[model samples]
Target: MRAIFAALLGLTTGMAMAEMKTEKVEYRDGDTVLEGYYAYDDAAYKGEKRPAILIVHDWNGLDGYEERRARELAALGYAAFAVDIYGKGVRPTNNAESGAQAGKYRADIDLFRSRLNAGLEALKARPGVDPARIGAIGYCFGGGGVLELLRSGAAVKAAVTFHGSLATPRPADAANIKAKILIQHASQDPSVPLTQLGDFIKEMGDAKVDYRMIMYNLAVHPFTVPGPQYNEVADKRSWAAMKEFFLENL
Candidate 1:
């Protein structure tokens, strides 16, 4: 009888894992084929409409890390999808290549916004998602992308950025922002220094936008990812802040 009970438990656990599902989604941005990852908890979303979040990936493009983040959002009863910034099979194996690919879009704001829109449209079309309660979150380069999404007056309810660059060529464009913005950053990050953050804050202030910036002391670039620079204290607190913000807004 004990052995039979153990078998039953194993079967139940396997079924549960299967219910928490993920799939690779093939999409497009004007002729460029994009590959993305979509994840959701089948059991939680059954017969119910839930909020959907569009996740933008780091400079490395849409990889395992982004999918894991999507799955985490799914566990919170969100239909999460990670969008591909680069074209299908265009992943960069090294920093030099990644920078070049991400730079092209960053240089041309129109192109970048369109690419993000393509993904947002795809996620919003999902049947299980509540189209009216849509939001977005980004990491690294992706974080910067979502800010641009808000600046372009996208139909997002909320937008969150994690350690993303706050710089843009046209600061006045913040006037067009429609979504509530939250920026979580590492204070000591070399790429996004205090001066840049200050200017971003001033832009939002001048535009009378609803936004907030939270900085973590002693935390540097890429603190949330699994690496030597990861700060457990900062990560835990920042993640809690994001969860709380989304719960209230989305």
Candidate 2:
């Protein structure tokens, strides 16, 4: 079932007006130091506060894909920060390594949520960011990370996940969610089956949270990424949907 956001499909972030200023931001989660990518249009909002968006990377860890998305968000007038979940210099080179790194957090929800919250805290502390008007978006594993942000009851107004993991060990924590959610998923994803989607819908319903889930038929896992699983239609539509969601919520 499509939610009330189907009309937002045509909304684009528009052309870039100025050079985006980007940098590597170093922050921490407890004793673990992390390095994230931060981008913003300094020409548009110099010394002025704006809503910020936190981006979580896929299973392979923070890389060029996530950073490019940060710049896109920056062009859209948001202070975007692409968060690092695997700590500084912990990027994984292949699926095996990425899965191993992501597995550690999956098995430990506390650490997963903490790392996400740490990123949120870092984004909130950045200059010219309005902490109250914050949102988060994640891709694949990172998508699950943003949902964890909701489950952890982080102070964010919006959360979006693209082809993310739907099952959470603590489904009861859904009640703690304080943000509106948008989920972009693949209808034919082998990694995430229909049963999982059903359970997730029920979890959100039981928690009485506002949420929307869009399914792209025939698209597989990680459909948004520009690779074998890439679904151009799904990627563009989902991104447009997110932009509209943030424009309204944040």
Candidate 3:
């Protein structure tokens, strides 16, 4: 996914880049101002409709990591949008703060879905975007947020969760899910217990939702990021799986 894009969405008011445009955008969910980053190769898909991706950031909220992924997607010929779940200027500086802000959304599933759905709206509104061929990917806290989006039936073609929380207050809401789901888990991760994963599997089965779950050996929480347990192999394989899944479905 890391190839140079020919054109980006353009950075703030258009940079006139001949290749790859990255831009910061301001959107809203209720009165909360949300800032997001988006990237696309307008020229790559010129006059041709293409799929789009919506990203929910990790617990720390919108940051460079998510935007970097957007560029990667743009390189692969997809419009990618990194949504702000914690609102503009609300990025968490530490794990404690990250947990607190993410907890707020977790505690209120409706709010979490509302904010994430707003991000989806932003993605769908982009020029040349195919509203029917949209997908979402999230990491950590954002991982759970994407599940919330599916539970709320946001109409995405697919959803991916990387080391995301499996417990949900409304497991029965899985009945409303329409998108295919992929869950990437770390085998040795301490944060998300096997028990939660089991319940999630049962929930998805009970709802008859299309889904796939993968557990990587010797990996742990935040395995895809810069962390003690980061497994390059696992990260690459998981991303490949996601890309393939989206290709088949979207």
Candidate 2 ranges with C-alpha deviation above 4 Å: 1-17
Residue pairs with colliding backbones in model 3 are 6-19, 6-20, 7-20, 7-21, 8-20, 8-21, 9-21, 10-21
Per-residue lDDT of model 2, residues 23-81, tens digit only: 99999999999999999987666677899999999999999999999999998999999
Tens-digit per-residue lDDT, 54-108, candidate 3: 9989988899899898999888888999999988899889989998998899899
When summed lDDT is taken over every stretch of 10 residues in candidate 1, the lowest stretch is 14-23
Please report the TM-score between candidate 3 and the true structure.
0.91
State every prediction's TM-score relative to the real structure: 0.92, 0.92, 0.91
Off by over 4 Å in 1: 1-18
Angstrom error of the Cα, residue 21, model 1: value is 1.7
Query: Can you give the lDDT of residue 5 in candidate 3?
Result: 42
lDDT of 1 by residue, 18-134 (tens): 477788888889999998899998877678898999999999988889999999998888999999988889999999999999999999999999999999988988778898888
Clashes of 2: 0
The CA lDDT at 33 in model 2 is 97
> 2 or 3: which has the higher lDDT?
2
Quote the positional error of residue 71 for candidate 2 in Å: 0.4
